[model samples]
Target: MNTTPVTSPVSNALAGWLATAETRANQKNEPAWALAKRSHAAAVASSLAFPTRDEELWRRTDFGGLPLDSLDPFAAVTPARNIDDLPVLLLTRLAGEGANTALVAQTDSEVVYEQTHPTLVKQGVIVCSMDRAIREHADKIQSLLGSLIATDYDRWTAVGEALRQGGAFVWVPKGVHAEIPVRLMQFLSGAGRLAAPRTVIAVGDGGSVTVVDELLSENAEGASMYLGGTELFIGQGAKLTFASLQDWSRNVYHYGNGRAQLAKDAELQWIQVMVGGRMSKTNIWFNLDGEGANAFVHGFMFGDSRQHFHLHTLQRHLKPNCTSDLLIKGCLKDKARSVYQGLIQVAEGAQKTNAYQANRNLLLSDQARADSIPGLEILANDVRCTHGATLGHVDSEHLFYLMARGLPRVEAERLVVEAFFEPVLERIPLESLREQLREEIERKIG
Candidate 1:
């Protein structure tokens, strides 16, 4: 075990690595087009300071007590076993289980496995490794790839763009709906290394596609960190359904976000499932530029044993007749804590916009804590925008009712909490998935 001991953010090792990363971005042989992206990303990442107590978001969260000095990235991870026939976690619910869904798997910044079902491939559906996309369809991919979450400023975002490897690039051509889903999974198998994960998805006019991104640590080993960022574009009258399952080891750090655009009459439904990670932060934002666009988003998170999961969602309505409703709820136990902040924005000309956001949490123990903030910004007088947040301990009355049924105290509390969350889980739309997620939560709480 190479326990050199992790260092603080200010360590000299991190400084040197940052410098080298900049050099790597500016190297020759790199096409001129990607040159600016790498250079700009490097420059931004070079000056990034670790968020501190002074920062509103970082004040409450700590990065696993890292050293005051920066630490070097760990060795790259490798898979020990093949995943040819593993039961797909959430995607198995779709019609064409393994036949129609495309898959892209990667480890330690290297694409280890990538396969697209031939049927979907022939449908003009593009599902392949992002690295390959950058090489084959550079022009089309480059134009819309990072447009949502531009790496021009944020340090982490820049690092992800500049050093990103082993991710997926998906494009659904006009009027084509993959009757089956296209799935992308990332496995961080290397020892304690860092993986920059990036995903770019573009849906053409009247096209529809469902995508699921799953991140897991192979065999639940290693202390790896994955910084992932994704961009989504839904063209006019298109529909895009995106779901993410993040289940890393308990000692890893995971941070990511989704930047999306919805053209006229485009519809997007996004669901997020949080199962693991010692500490995680996720940010998602949607631009409702097309009239009659709709976004239905829901999130489920479970935390335990000093784990922390923080999420922030932004809904931006820039056109009339756009509608968005968000519901995110979580449960905490074993000294774990989490926060959910949702923001909804309606522009001045976005009359008739309907935006509603809600976040609720149920803490199972006194030691567990949850903070929720739901906010709204409306500049249109004719818009209906509402936001609400609720934080409370497990319902004692519900527990009492369960206990009255002869259930033990611990069991009663668990039942009540489960009952409280079933409404949200039931909305998942997939039967097997809904039940499977229910089991995961049951296991988590028990």
Candidate 2:
């Protein structure tokens, strides 16, 4: 790993802000364990080299034009606002009637609002801010915070962990089953500000939970930056459904790292929808560590204007009889561009493992671009692995067929594009959320 300090203007600005974050953490009376981790991450971030265009992972995506020094890493938190101001669907999902869900909302650095249903509280489910978790659920938080997505994954991960101010922590006890989902909303409100949130979710043996995370901005005016991390742990025989929706303003730049670890007989279903952000880069990983483990990852992306997206995924099978599947689809228009890179690895002892990966892209305009790279590494001869990628334009015959049936040309094209994404959209568990995504897609298609 490269440890030389980066000399870019962005790196230097981040270094100065990280130093200030350490000072603030010390003065806040933070727990010793949490403080130590933050300090170590900050040091690592300062020494690590920033990603350049030469690196294979970043060669296609450019970050050279970003004015990193103009963004504030230690911006002050704005005052809290009423939940009524948010969208009706989001409000219903977060704190709806008869729903045993937990909700946490953060703006800038502070957790402006947090609530947990009383019934879930009685069942030993913990849903609160990271700050509160560090003070109240110290043992559980310390054991799982950086266990999955370690701080050293890259400079961005280290920056997110070191400077993170607030996020959600959820724990479901053994044998407990949460019928309703736990929801977290992180909103960026001001321009030239930085938002870094770290989320950790752990389900005990035989337990189950559904989690939904949303990242949004008020509008598409001022420029902002978002650096975030997420870790999920599923114990033996446990099941988890995780979904993330990112709709930041067109002026914001976002980067995130997410990971999940599964034990024997554990199952994980992950869904990600990306429809916003000026330039976004996200990396997701899954580890199957025990027999009979299963995982499924699905993602959707839509980009317009000059927006850029770089998405990467990894699936690692370390035990026997494990299964994994991944499918990511995107549509690009105008001058937008997208890149998808995926890898599936089966260890030597991971016999009877089955894995599949695919990425499909649709170019809606002549100037739009999309790149897909899918790979597999199998050390076990008995295992089965496959990978494929496709990049194509809208089928002209299909469009013409729809137009001949009394639909306008634009409407026909939109319908065909919607059909292209329906396979992934139909898999979303929530009807309301699915409809919301459909509406967003429709708006973009127009």
RMSD after CA superposition, every candidate: 4.4, 3.8
- Find the candidate with the highest lDDT and give its number: 2
Error of 2 at 187 (Å): 0.3
Error of 2 at 111 (Å): 1.2
- Candidate 1 stretches with Cα past 4 Å from truth are 1-12, 15-30, 67-100, 218-222, 427-435
Could you estimate the TM-score for every candidate? 0.88, 0.94
What are the per-residue Cα lDDT tens digits for candidate 1 across 31-103? 5676677666666766675566676666666664543232234345453243453334323433345444577
State which candidate has the highest TM-score.
Answer: 2
Colliding pairs, model 1: 7-67, 8-67, 8-68, 8-69, 11-69, 11-70, 77-189, 77-190, 264-290
* Total backbone clashes of candidate 1, pairs 3 or more residues apart or in separate chains: 9
| lDDT accuracy of residue 229 in candidate 1 | 88
- The segments of candidate 2 whose C-alpha lies over 4 angstroms from its true place after superposition are 1-12, 79-82, 85-100
TM-score of candidate 2 relative to the true fold: 0.94
